[model samples]
Every structure is written in structure tokens, then in C-alpha cells.
Target chain A: MRNIKLIIEYDGTRYFGWQKQPELRTIQEEIENAIKKITKEDVKLIGSGRTDRGVHARGQVANFHTNSRIPADKFKFALNSVLPFDISIKESTQVDESFHARYSAKGKQYRYLVYNSKTRSPLLRDYSYHVPYTLDLYKIREGAKFFIGTYDFRAFMSSKSCVEDTIRTIYNLEIIENGDLIELKVKGNGFLYNMVRIIVGTLIEVGCGKKKIQDIPKIIESKDRNEAGHTAQPQGLYLDKVFY
Target chain B: MRNIKLIIEYDGTRYFGWQKQPELRTIQEEIENAIKKITKEDVKLIGSGRTDRGVHARGQVANFHTNSRIPADKFKFALNSVLPFDISIKESTQVDESFHARYSAKGKQYRYLVYNSKTRSPLLRDYSYHVPYTLDLYKIREGAKFFIGTYDFRAFMSSKSCVEDTIRTIYNLEIIENGDLIELKVKGNGFLYNMVRIIVGTLIEVGCGKKKIQDIPKIIESKDRNEAGHTAQPQGLYLDKVFY
Candidate 1:
């Protein structure tokens, strides 16, 4: 069997999520069905991680083992032809048999978009979180710095998540402000469930004068989910890239 | 009675068009209905021009006459509270009764987006027209310059249009290339039906080696609709602004 890797991009607006459910529409099932149509095999495709409903992805990585003789590069075209317009195979390649989409991933990059304006944007409704309040950029920037470096990120994760290892190293976190759009680009070795959204929410709190910039360190030290700010909306979050 | 002016923005994906038709959902009708709900009066909303289905707008202009006691600026907030998520009244103010949305408009600016890439972009699916083939930007830029002048643009119009005067002045036609996206921004005193789309299509043909760059003047001089290229898709078109 040959191990094939695929890079995917999806709108996620119409999808339940990346994970496969019995009766729900999902990105995983759609691609798996498309793969079945092309290869006639019941392949279990492994994604780098699961994104919640309405969460988009630009470089979601996945892999599957197949016995088919189709060329590695050809899988992208073939799969894309049968997949829905909301999901697309960006690149496909044959990798070593030992390679796994989830296990072999070294790190991930995510971006969260905040539309800070007085009025709602019809064009950006599905792609950004609207914060109809003026945000202090200087405060948000200062607060974001505390999230970087190795720390127990349990406070930033969702309470529903039961992962034993909550300690994650954030490599970098950058805030880019362009007009009404505030983009948070984060790179981390691993993130707990809802970690990025929580971090974004915390930073937004600091920007809105709800939380102080100096409070981020204490929030992280608490290692309690309640100590952090609310989890931001799923629509604003995007899985940017999965590093191998 | 007060003559109120409105600057509107809409996604336009779910709207039939800007015009009101029986049993069909339109941007004009939606706003009119919202106005009726607020003032309990049937008001006719006059738009600068009609945008086709799926064609978006960043700054569309409109006006309506009303006898309601609501403040001009407060109408934006009041109507927005009852309007759908896909439509927004950006700004509203009292204007002179002599001002008309369509007749008083001096010029308009439009933008067309072409996503030049091999694979389709799911995120940009509703926003841009995807051109799979690689286009020669230099040729496109050279061909676009010919459109920046007064001319009888009959050949660039749709056959369904029955306008007597086909002459119009193009103030500027700019081609902005950024990564895999090509944006064509055009300002004109007036445009015939499908003029901007045809111009974009013709320029794209020139970029793809289908039409010659020097042949633009001849195509314009032909004054025949058949002499022009195909009309581009509505999704890629945006009514950027209406100047009075």
C-alpha cells in the first residue's frame, strides 16, 4: 500500500465540520466519498485535526493508504473533480508508508479575523467575527505577547475538552490590523480544543478594556478555562497551515 | 416630507437583483418592505442602477421620499434592525428634493475580480471569477488602456439592451494585479447593459492570446455586439461606488 498525502482547502460554511458523522454533512465524508468514486476503495482518510462547524481552512493536511496505481499528483485533480465546490484538493503527493497526517504533523498555524466596525458587513458575515466596538490596538498587541512561549494553556482551551496534556508551546503570535479587520496569526506546536479562539477572545477583551493587558500572565498561570475570556465564534477562525 | 439619501452595501448572493418583481426577492423590495414596516407607509426606493443577481455592492446609492418623523441618520439604524443580514444601509441623510438616485448620478465606478489559478478557491467562490489558465498580465494591462476614453461602446453592450445612445466617456480603466487575483477598476460617465463585463472579457481574451492587444480599437470601432468577447459572470462584478 502507498501512503498518499493531500492538502485541502474548504469554505466550511455548508459543512458540519472536518470530522465524519453518521448522518451529517462533513468535509471528511465528502472527500472520502469522492475518493471512493475514483479508487473504489473504502479508504479511511486521516486529517491533521478537526475544525468545528463553520471554521474554514486554507492548508488542511490529510493522508490515506491506498492500493490504487493512480499517480500521486493525479489524485488532486481526480478528487477535486468529484468533490463539492466548497472543498478542493490543493496538492497530493505520495509519501513514505510511515507518514501519518495527524501524527507526523509538527506544528500548525491559525488566523482569526475580527471585523471591528460600528455596522455589520454583509460581505464579511460568514468570514469574520463582528465586534461593533472600537478596539485599542496597542492594548491588544501588548496582551498578545504573554501568550507566546511554553506554558500550560489549559486556561485557553474549551472546558469540554478532556486532553490530559494541556501544556503547549506557542511559537509566535502576531496581530495585523488592516482597516476594520484585525487578524491574529498564531503558530504553535500544538493547540488544545478552542485554544486559538480563547486566546483571540482574551486579546479582544484587553482591547475593549474588559480585561487588562497585565492579566494574561495570571490567566495562563491559573490553568482554568473560566479564568480566560469567552471562545470566539467559529466563523472567524481558520486553520491556515499544518506544518510537517 | 423629507427626501432621504442612502448609501447601501449588500452581498447580493441571495437577492434576485436590485429591482422589485412580483414574488421574487430583491434588494430594492427588501429595503422598501423594511421602510414600510418602520413608517407604515408605502415608499418607492429609487436606486442609482440595478445590479444583476449575485453581483455585490460596496457603495450603492439610493433615495426615498417619506413623511415619517424619524431623523434622517436614525433611519439607518432603524431599518438595519429589521433588515436581513445580507443587506445593510451604510449611511442615510436628508437630501434636497431635486436630487434623484438614478437621474442625478454623474458617474459610477465598478470593479471586477478574476482569480487566476489552477485550482478553484472555495473561500473566493462567491466573490471572484476563477480563470484556470495563466493570463499574460502585461498584455491585459496594455489592452485595458484603450478603454480609457470617450467612445461609442455599442459593441461592448448586451444585445438585450435597447438604449439609443451608446456613446459614453470612460474616465479611467485600471488593471491591478495582486498575486493570483486580477482586479479591473473602471470609472465611467455611463455604461450600457453588460459593458463592463464585456470589456473585462475582451481584455481577458487579449491576456490569454485569444485576442490581440492592438485589436481593441478595431473592436470598439466595429460598433457590433458580436465583435466583443463573452460577458463575464455576475459574481465577479461589484458596484464600487456611485458618484453624484
Candidate 2:
């Protein structure tokens, strides 16, 4: 028996999510099936995290156990060929028996894309939130600065979330602009479900003059979801990287 | 009747192409239908150029005649509300009676996106071409430099294209990189049918060391299309902007 770790990428548009659910198309189930077909053994793949429908990933980590003639490094190419075009294996390596994709991760990074223009771009429809207003970029930058550090992010989490701890440490956050595209990059030791989306929505409000950049600290202290910004559209968020 | 010029954006994935075709869904037909819904008038939009099926557009130009009560500046907002999210009007302005979308355009810009990495990105399945091999950037740049002048691009067009004059000025051609994303941005007065894709395909070959950079000028000088590289996949090419 051997364990394999994979660097994964996926377009979550047509998927139910990362986890397997009955009668639903999922990233996890697909990867498992691909491995089963190759190894003739049912293998359970452990993913770094779950992403909601219509979200995306650039570098998601996953691991599985298998007993097959195929080498670990060769799994990337084999699985990629069998996987759907929207899901791919970037890299695969042999791992210890105790290695777990989700449990062994030290931190994660996410990016939310916003297209700030007077009109929406069809080219970016599935990948970005369109805001047809003048954005105060400086205020948004200041707001991003406020998010860095340890905080109880209960105010930013969705009520539907089932995580145990409300406390998380955001290591870094930055808003970068490239033409009309603005990306909100955030890294943290842990995230509350929908925390990134809520942060993006609140920061956008700050950019649009509906909220103050300095108000984020107060909202975090309040520990009430209503005190934070609205949850942003899911299509704009991406799991950029999962660090181990 | 007032003539309105529009900066249009479209997801050409579902449409037959940019032009009107009775046999299939078209970008022109969809926009016309949206206009008829609001104005109760059948209208045909003339686009700056035709794009192939499964292609995309970021800043396509088009024009139509309307005597509707909606203001010209408000046309984009009004039309966007009714149009599919994948097809949108980015901007609109009342144009002179003599202005035509196709004829008045002085130049056009197109971009071909390539995801250069060891693994394919699932999110970019339809948005870019995935090349897993490491690319030699300097070699690709050298080949790209050959395309930056007025020249007859007869060798670069596909046989299916029907254009009498192949002489076009390539004002600028550049390859830009950001992380794993690489964009081949080219602005020119005009392009031969499949010219951009052919150039991009050739550049990729050069980047991968499949072809020599010095051979590009020789291929361009040849009048036969067979002398050029194969046309790159259509999905990665975008009609980025049209200048009037």
C-alpha cells in the first residue's frame, strides 16, 4: 500500500462541490473514480477543503491511498488524461501513511476577483463580480490592511457554516489592480466558511463609500455576522493555493 | 433614426459566431432579439469583424439603428438587464448617421491566452490554451518581433479564408507573462483570417523549441498558407479591442 498526494486544479462551475454527495457531480467523486479505474481499487481521496458550487481552484491539495503498479509521479499524467477538462492533476508525489491533505495543511490562500467598470465583461462573467461604480481603490487597500492579524471572524462567517472555531489568523491581505480587474488576495491559517466572500463584499462597500475601512475592526469585535458586509457572489472566489 | 455605436462583449461559446446565420445561434441575432424586445423593432447589428464559433470578445464594436426613446448612453445598462449574462453591452454612444461599425474601425487588437504550467487549470478550460511544457520565453519573443511591421500575411491565413488583399500592418505584437498566465497581445490595423491564431501557434512552436525563431520571417514571406504554422485552437483567441 502507498499514499499519493496531488496538487489539483478545478473549475467548480458544473460541480456540486468538492465533497461527494449522492446523485451529485463532485470533484472528489470524480477523482476517486478516476483512481479506481486506473488501479482497480476504490480509493478515498482527501481534499484540502470544500468549495461551493461555481467557485474555482488553482492549487487544491488532495491525497489518496492505493495499491497499484503505477508509480506516484506518473499519476499526474494518467489522472489528467482521464479527468474531465475542468479538473486536472498538476502534480502527484508519494507520501507517508500518516499524511492527510486537509489535516497537514498549515495555511491557505484565496482570491476574489472584481471587475470594476461601468459595464460588465462577458469574458469574465463566470470569474468575476462586476461593480459598475467608481471604486475608491485607496480605501479598499486600507481596508485590506485592517484584515491582517488574529481575530475572531464570527462576524464574517456565514450562518450556514458548521466550523467549530470562530477564531482565525489572517497572515496577509492585498488588493491588486490590473487594468479593470481588481483581485483581493488573502492568506490565513484558517477561514470561516464564506469569510473570504464576506470580506470582499465588505471591502467593496468600503470602495463604494457605503462603509468605512476602519469599521472592519469594530465589526470583528462585535462577533455578529450582520455587522460585517454582505456575502459576495460565489462565482468570483477561488481557492488559489493550499500550503502545507 | 439615431445610429448607436456599441462596445460589445460576448461569450462566443454558445453562439455560431459574431455574424448573423439563419442556421444557428449568433451574437448578432441575440443582440437583435434583445433590442426588438425593448423597441418592438427588428434590428440587425453590423459588427466590426466576424469571429469564429467558440471564440470570445472583450471589446468588440458594433452599430445599429434605432429611434427608440431610450437614451444612447443608457443603452448599455438597459440592454444588459435583458441580455444573457454571457452576452453584454459594455458601452454605447449615439453615432453619426454615416458611421458604420465595420467600416469606420481603423485598427483592432486581439489576444491569445496560454496557461503555461506543468498542469492545466480547470477554470481556464474554455478561456485559454494549456501548454504544460516549459516555454523558452526569449525564443518566443524573437519570433514575435518578426510580426511587428506592415506585411502581407498571405502565408499566415487558413485556406478557408476568402480575402483578396492580405497586406496588413501589425502595429504592435508582444508577449506578456503574469505568473502562470501568458498573453500574446497584438494590435494591428487589420488581420488576415486566422492570422492571430496562426501566429500564436507558430510562437508556441518556437517557444517549445519545435521550430527555430529565424524561420518565422521566411514563413511570413511565403505567399502559401501551407508554409505557416497550424492555427491555434479558437477558444483561446479573443477579439480584445477595436479602435476607430
Candidate 3:
């Protein structure tokens, strides 16, 4: 048996999410079906993580075990020919039997894009969150600094998340401005469900002067979901990179 | 009655071009419907040009005669509230009674985006044309210079175009590279049907060594459609600006 690792990219606008659902279109289902067509094997494809509906990904990782003898590098070309235009296999390679896509990940990077303008932009409607109000970058930066380092991000997680331990280490977090677009880049060992979106919502509140910069520490210490800001919309979020 | 001018932006992926067609979803039809909803008047919307299906626009110009008492500047917000998310009115103002969107235009700038990568990008599927081979930027620049100045560009026009006079003055043409994307910007007093797409197609041929750089002038002089390259796809074309 050969273990194959795949680097995937997808525009998740029309997809239900990364995971497969009965009689619903999904990123994983499309990829798995494509693999089935290529290898003629019913193999289980595992993703590094689950991104919510409407979330995009530039470098999502996945792996599967198959008995097909096709060359590893050629799988990318083969899969792309069969996959939908919105989902593409960027790269494919053979890995050891011990390799696991979800467990072996070292870190991941995510980017949330926001379009700050009085009027919404048609070109960026699906890719960015439109904020009509002017955002204070200084306050946003101050709020971003609070998310760095290791901490229990329970307050930032969604109530629907079933994960018991919410401890995670954030390696870096920064905000970048490009014209009218604002980008929030976060890299961490792992993320809880809806944690990144909640953090972004809280930071936006600080940027807009709705919340004080000093309130972030208290929100984190509270460990209650209600203490944090509302969860941001998923359209602006992108799973940028997955490292192993 | 007041002639209201609108600066429009739209993602043309889902529309049937700029012109109104029977039972077809079009940019003009959408705008006219939105205007009817706001003013309760059936008005004809004149667009600066007829962009082919799947061609985007960032600064497309249009005008309509209306008897509504809404302020000109406030028309933007009022119209955008009723328009679909894919189309937006960026600016609105009252123009001179004699001004017409199609006839009074002085110059127009169009941009063609090409993704020069070995693999197609999922995010740019509808926004850019994907060329797998490496394009020679220097050759593209050299070929771009031939399109400048006054020229009778009958050879660059599509056979289906009904325009009698093919003479047009190209003010400027330049090629810009940003990472994996190549932008071909062309500004001209006016353009014939499919003229920009044909020019881009010829330039790509020159960049890929399919055609020699010295053959450009001869092709232009031929004034025969068969002498020029094929028309590029409409997805990469964007009506960038209109200078009155």
C-alpha cells in the first residue's frame, strides 16, 4: 500500500464545507470521487482540518492510502483533470505509512480579508468582508498582539465546538493593509472551531472603538463565549497554508 | 428630465454581456430593473460599450434619463441598495443634456489579465485567463509597441462585428507583470468589436514564439481578419476606465 499526500486549493463559495455530507456537494467529496475515478479504489481521504462553508483555502493538506501503482507526482495532474475547476490538487507525493494528514501537522496559517470602503466592491464580494466604517489600524494592531503566545482560547471558540481542551499556541498574528483591503494573518499550532473568526470579530470591535484594547485579556480570562465578540462571517477567511 | 451618469462595476461571470437581450440576464437589464424599482419608470440605459459575456468592468460608464427628484449624488446609494451584489454603482452624477454614454465618450482603458502559471489557480478561475506555458514578457512588450498610434485595425476585429469604419487611435499599450499575473493595459480613443481580445491573442502568440515580432505591422496592414490571431477569451478582459 502507498500513502499519498496531496496539497489542495479550493474556492469554497458553493461548497457545503470540507467534509462530505449525504447528497450534498463538498470539497472532500469531490476530491474523493476524483480519486476513486483515477485509482478505482474506495480509499478514505483525510484532511488536515475542516474549514467552514464559504471559507477558501490556498494550501489545504490531505492524505489517503491506496494500492494503485500510479506515480506519486503524476497524481496531481491526474486529479486536476477530473476535479472541478474550483478544487485543484496543487501537489501530490508519496509519504511513509506512518504519516497522518491531521495528526502530523506542525502548524497552519490563516488569512482573513476585509474590504474597508464606504461602498461595497463587486469584484471582492465573495472574497472579502465589507466594513463600511473606517477601521483604526493602531487599535487593531494592539488587539492582535493579545492573541500571540500559548493560551486557552475557550472564550474565542464557538459554542458548537465539542473539543474539551482549548489550549493552543499562536506563533504569530499581524494585520496588513493593501489599498482598501485589510488582511489579518494568523499562524498557530492548531485552531479551535470558529476561534479565528471570533478573534477577528473582537479585533474589529477594538479597531472601531466598540471595545477597549485592554479588554482582550479579560475576555480571554473569562473563558466564556459570550464575553467575546460575534463570530465573523466565513466568506473572508482563507486557510492559507498547512505545514508539517 | 435629467441625464444621470453612472460609473458602474460588475463581475460579469454570470451575466450575458452588457447589452439587453430577450430573456437573458445582462448587466444592462439588471441596472434598468434596479432603476425601475427606484424611480418606477421604464428607462433605457445606455452603456459606454458592449462588453462581451464574462467580461468584467471596474469603471464602466452608463446614463439614463429619469424624472425622479432624488439628488444625483445620492442615486448611487439608492440604486446600490436595490441592485444585485454582482453589480454596483460606484458613482452617480447629473450630466449635460447632450451627454450620451455611447457617443460622448472620448477615450477608454481596458485591462486583460493573464495568469502565467504551470497550474491554474482556483481563486482566479473566472477573473483571469490561464496560460500554462512560460510567456516571454520582453517579446510581449515588443509586440505591444506595434499597436500604438492611429491605425485601421480591420484585421484585429471579429468577423461578426458590423462596424463600417475600423479606424481607431490607440493612445497607449503596455504590459505589466505582478508575480504570476500579466496585465495588458490598452488605452484607445475607441475600440471595435472584439478588438482588445484579438490584440491580446496576437500578443500571446508573439510571446510564445508562435508568431514573429516583425510580423505585427504586416498583419495590421493586411486588414484581413484571417491574418490575425484568434480572439482571446472574454473572462480576462476588464473595462477599466473611461475618460471623457
Candidate 4:
């Protein structure tokens, strides 16, 4: 059996998420169905992680074992031809039999976009969170510094997350401003459920002066979900890259 | 009676067009219904111009005569509350009774976005035209310069256009490249039907070496629709601004 790795990109606006649900449409289900048509095998596709509904991806990684003789790279073109316009395979390659999409990943990067303007943008409605308030970039940058480094990020995760380990190392976090858009980029060893969105929400509070920049450390130390700000909407979050 | 002018924005993905067609969902129909709900008046909504199906708008202007006592500016907020999420009123103000939406416009600006890359981007799928071939930016820039100035644009318009006068003055036409995206911005006193799309198509041909830069003048002089390149798709065209 050959382990094939695929780099996927999808607009998650109309999807339930990255995982397969019983009845609802999902990114994983669509790709798997496309594979079945191409390889004539009921392959089990394993994604690096799950992205929530309305969350987009640019470099999401997935792996599947198949016995077909199709060249690895050709899978990108073949699958894209059958897949819906919203989902596409950016790249594909053959990997060692032991390689796993999720377990072998060393780190991941995520980006959350916010349209900070008095008026909402029709072009960006699906891709960005529109905040019709002036955000203080200086305060946002100050708060972002606290997220870097290894720590127990229990406070940033959703309460519904079933994962036992709450500890994670954030390698980098930065805020980039372009015109009326604010982008929050974060790289971490691994993220807890809803961790990125919650972090963005907290930072937005800091940017708007609702929360002090110095309070971020205390919030992280508290390790309580309630202590953090509201979870930002899923539409603004994107899986930017997966490092292996 | 007051003539209320509105600056509008919309994602045209799900809309048929800017015009109100019986039994068809359109931007004008939606706004007219919203107006009826707000003021209980069967008012006629006139747009600055008709944008084809799947064409977006950032600053599309429209006007309507109403006798309601509701403040002019408040119409923006009122209409937005009832309009679909894809449509938004950016600004609203009272104009003179003689101000007509279509006839009184002095100029218009349209922008066409092309994603020039080997791989298509899911994020820009709705807004940009994907062209995988390598294009010569220099050739496109050269071709654009020929389009600046007054000319009879019959060759660049759709054959279906019924207007007798095809002469229009192009104030500026520029090609801007940012990363993998190419922006074609054109400002003109008036445009023939499908004029901008056809111009973009011809320029794309020029960039790809399919058509020479010197052929543009002949295409314009021919005054035949068949003389120009194919009309580019509607999704990439945006009504950027409408001048009074």
C-alpha cells in the first residue's frame, strides 16, 4: 500500500467542516467521494485536523492509502476535475508507508482576518469578520506578544473540547494590517479546539480597549475559558499551513 | 417628493443582475421590496447602470423618488436591515429632483481582477478570473495605453448592444500587478455594453502573445464586434465607482 499525501484548499462557507458527518456536506466526504471515483477504492482519508464549519483552508494536509497505480501527482489534477469548485487539491505526493497526515505533522499555522472599517465590505463578507470599530494596532501588538512561547492554553480553548492535554507551544504570533483589513497569524506546535478563534477574540478586545494588554498573561495563567474574550466567528479563521 | 440617492455594494454571486426582472431575483427587485416594506410605497428604483449577472459592485449608485417623511440618510440603515446579507447600502443622501441615476452620471470606473497562477485559489474563486498561463505584463501595459482617449468602441462591445452611439472617452486604463493577482482598472466617461470585458479579453490575448500590441488600433478602427477578443466572464468585473 502507498501512503499518498495531499495538500488541499477549500472555501468552507457552505461546508459543515473538515470531518465527515452523517448527513451534512463536508470537505472530507467530498474528497473521499472523488477518490472513490478515481481509484475505485473505498479509501479512508485522514486529515491533519478538523476545521469548524465556515472555516477555510489554504494548506490543509490529508493522507490516504490506496493500491491504485495512478501517479501521486496526477491525483491532484484528477481529483480537482471531479471535486466541487469550492474544494481543490493544491499538491499531491507519495510518502513512506508509515507516514501519517496528523501524527507526523510538526506544527501548524493559522490566520484570522478581520475587516476593520466603519462600513462592511461585500467582497470580503465570506472571508473576513467585519468589525465596524477602530482598532488600536499598538495595543493589539502588545497583547500578541503574550501568546508566544510554551504554555498551558486551557483558557483559550473551547469548553466543549474533549482533549486531555491543554499544554501547547506557540512559536509565533503577529498582527499584520493592510488597508482596512487586520490579519492575525499564529504558528503553534498544536492547537486545542477553538484555540485560534478564542485568541483572536481576546486580541480584538485588547485592540478595542475593552481589555488591557497586560491582562493577557493573567488570562492565560488562569487557564479558564470564561476568562478569555468571546470566540471570534469561524468564517474569519483559515488553516494557512501545516509544517511537517 | 425627494430624490434619494444610494451608494450600494453587493456580492453578485447569487444575484441575477442589477435590473428588476419579473419572477427573477435581482438587486433592484430586492431593494424595491425593501423600500415597499419600509415606506409602504411602490417606488421605482433606478440604478446608475445595469451590471450583468454575477458582476459585483463596490460603489454602484441608484436613485428613487419617494414622498415618505423618513430622513434620507436613515434610508441606508433601514434598507440594509431588510436586504439580503449579500447586498448592502453604503451611503444614502437626498439628491435634486432632476438628478437621474443613469442619465445624470458623468463617469464610471470598473475593475477586473485576474488571478494569474498555475494553481487556483479557493479564496478568490468568486471574485477573480483564474488564468493559469504565464502572461507578459509589459505587453498588457502597452496594449492598455492604446485604450486611453476617445474612440468609437463598437468593436469592443457585445453584438447584442442596441445603443447607436458607440463613441466613448476612456480617461485611464492601467494594469496593476500585486503578487499573483492582476488588476485591470478603467475609468471612462461612458462605456458600450460589454466594452470593459472585451477590452480585458483583448489585453489578455496581447499578454499571451496571441495578439500583437499594434493590433489594438486596427481592432478599434474596424468597428466590428468580431474584430475584438472574446468578452471576458462577468464575475471578475466590478463597478468600482460611479461619478456624479
Residue A77, model 2: lDDT of 91
* Pairs of colliding residues, candidate 3: none
TM-score of 2: 0.97
Write model 4 residue lDDT over B122-165, tens digit each, in one string. Answer: 88888988888999999999999999999999999899989999
Q: Give the TM-scores of the predictions, in the order they appear.
A: 0.97, 0.97, 0.94, 0.95
Which one wins on DockQ? Answer: 1
Global lDDT of each candidate? 0.94, 0.90, 0.94, 0.94
Off by over 4 Å in 2: none
Query: Per TM-score, what order, best first?
Result: 1, 2, 4, 3
Worst 10 residues of 4 chain B by lDDT: B117-126
lDDT of 4 by residue, A33-57 (tens): 9999999999999999999999999
Better of 1 and 4 by TM-score: 1
DockQ of 2: 0.79
For model 4, fnat equals 0.49
> In angstroms, how far off is A139's CA in candidate 1?
1.7
Residue-wise C-alpha lDDT for candidate 1, range A23-98, written one tens digit per residue: 9999999999999999999999999999999999999999999999999999999998999999999899999999
In candidate 1, the residue pairs with backbone N, CA or C atoms under 3 Å apart (3 or more residues apart, or in different chains) clash, namely none
